[model samples]
Target: MRRKLAAGNWKMNGLVDDLSEIKALTEAHPDPDVDMLICAPATLIAQMAWARGTHALQIGGQTCHAERSGAHTGDISAPMLRDAGASHVLVGHSERRTDHGETDADVAGQAAAAHAAGLVAVICIGETLDQRESGHALTVITDQLRGSLPPGATAANTVIAYEPVWAIGTGKVPTTEQIGEVHGTLRATLRDLMKQAEGVRLLYGGSVKGSNAGEIFAVADVDGALVGGASLKAADFSPIVSALENA
Candidate 1:
């Protein structure tokens, strides 16, 4: 059976004072059936880890370095994230791709590093609005899927997210039919690439919230979501998590 995941990308948000929201989440939803995770800022990993309990509230890193230990002044390595209590690390988020100028090879190397350090690599891929408008969204995303994912990316150590660049934080979402189409393509690609290995869960992102998650998850090949803004608050995020339980 495929497990449904409800992951929260807190982005650069959250502070020491915001741990209360996590506390509420862990308390309100003890033992969430849906695979639950929160990718917080690097600075808060340790604190969140300390508070983590059997609720299965797994914590992940927003990003990690491709190099284990290098002169990259501002880079945090996968091992470092592991040491800081992260079980997973997000790679190739559009923000990183745009702001840091990361390429497919860079993301692949980062996923390799994450695997080397025993962490699940959450690989993100998406296309801009212009690409979608020009009817090139699938081509762009497929190209990224072909280039960014590395060898040895199995279901156990990796997850893929399709976050449309135009939809993220913009309160827009691809129609249900559109999501199914892309996800189905992604599934076929992954199956062929992996030579028929199963358990690789494909997640949809881009402005996912409680209101729209059920419909999104209903789409073929969509096993989960990588939620953005709504994740900042437990009230908004908890329902999305619950949505997965009955999805």
Candidate 2:
């Protein structure tokens, strides 16, 4: 069975003081039934990992460089994240794709690097508002799913997150039916591409919060969520985790 994952993308947010949130989370949900993870900014991965020591809380990087080591300036590598105690890394987040102009191939390379470093790659794919309006959402996401994923990606080292561009941080979310369609399609695509598809977890992201988390988790094939803004606090995030646990 696929394990449910409630992952938080702190995204460029959080300071040394913010680490307290992790303490509150672990204390509240110690031994949570669902897997818990917080993907903080590069600066905080090591500290967050340290704070989560011997706890069920997992720490991860928001992104990583495709090359193991190079003169890529500010880029952080997968091995570096692993060395800092990160067990996973998010690849191809929408902001990265939009801000850095990362193509699907670039994301694939990053995921491959994460795999080589023995870290799970939470690969992200999504459609823009324009595409959704044009009835091209499925086509766009399917293309991304095909291109962003690397060869040899298995359930153990790979996860897929679908976050609609328009919904992220916009307080807008795709209806449960829409989420189901996309997740189901993603599942089928994974099944066709890899033998370990059944074990792979599919997470829905985009304006996910405790208020809507239960309904979202109930959708078919939605193993969990890749939460943003709401993840920054324990009060807001813990209830979402509880929803997933009951789901």
Candidate 3:
């Protein structure tokens, strides 16, 4: 069975002062049954790791450069994130794809870099509102999986997150059925592509919160969530963790 993961992407948010929220989260679930992680902004990754102390709370980077080290100005590399105590790094988040125009091959490169640095690569794939409405959501996401996954990815070092573009931060969530269909398709796609597919965790993102987490977690093949806005606070995020544990 795949271990459930409740991962948060602080996404261009949080500072040194914000470390307390993670601290509180560790305190709330000192011995959580499921894994807990926060992918903070680059500036706060090291500090958050320090704040987590001896707790099981994991710290990660929102994104990392495809290259281990390069002349690329303003880019953080995977090795750097690992050096700062991050055990994982997000690759190909929708915002990054939209804002930076990252292609699937670019994401594959980044994932490879993360693997080289001994960090888990949470590879994100999703569809826009138009694609879903046009009945191409599954095709789009599957294509992304085929194109974005690195050459050497395995269940232990890779995770997949599906976040519908329209649902993120929009207070809109895909119905449980919609989530199930996507996750099911993703699982099949992984099975066809990798020998370790069944052990890989599949997480649903986009407007995930405590109120909806239980139902979402109930879906088949949904190992957990890649929470966004709701993850910034302990009161909001703890319940989601609880829901996953009970799920």
Model 3 CA lDDT for position 229? 93
Off by over 4 Å in 2: none
lDDT of each: 0.90, 0.95, 0.95
Tens digits of lDDT, candidate 1, 105-218:
999999999999999999999999999999998888888988888898888999999999999999999999999989988887887788634688899999898888889888
Please give, for residues 1-247, the per-residue lDDT of candidate 2 as tens digits. Answer: 8889999999989999999999999999989999999999989988998898789888899999999998999999999999998999999999999999999999999999999999999999999999999999999999999999999899999999999999999999999999999999999988888999999999999999999999999999999999999999999999999999999
Per-residue lDDT tens digits for candidate 3, residues 1-247, read 8999999999988878888898789989999999998999989988888898899888889899988897999999999999999999999999999999999999999999999999999999999999999999999999999999988999999999999999999999999999999999999999889999999999999999998999999999999999999999999999999999999
Report the number of backbone clashes for model 1. 0
Residue 182 CA displacement from its true place in model 2, Å = 0.4
| lDDT winner, 1 or 3 | 3
Badly placed stretches (over 4 Å) of model 1 are none
Of candidates 2 and 1, the better by TM-score: 2
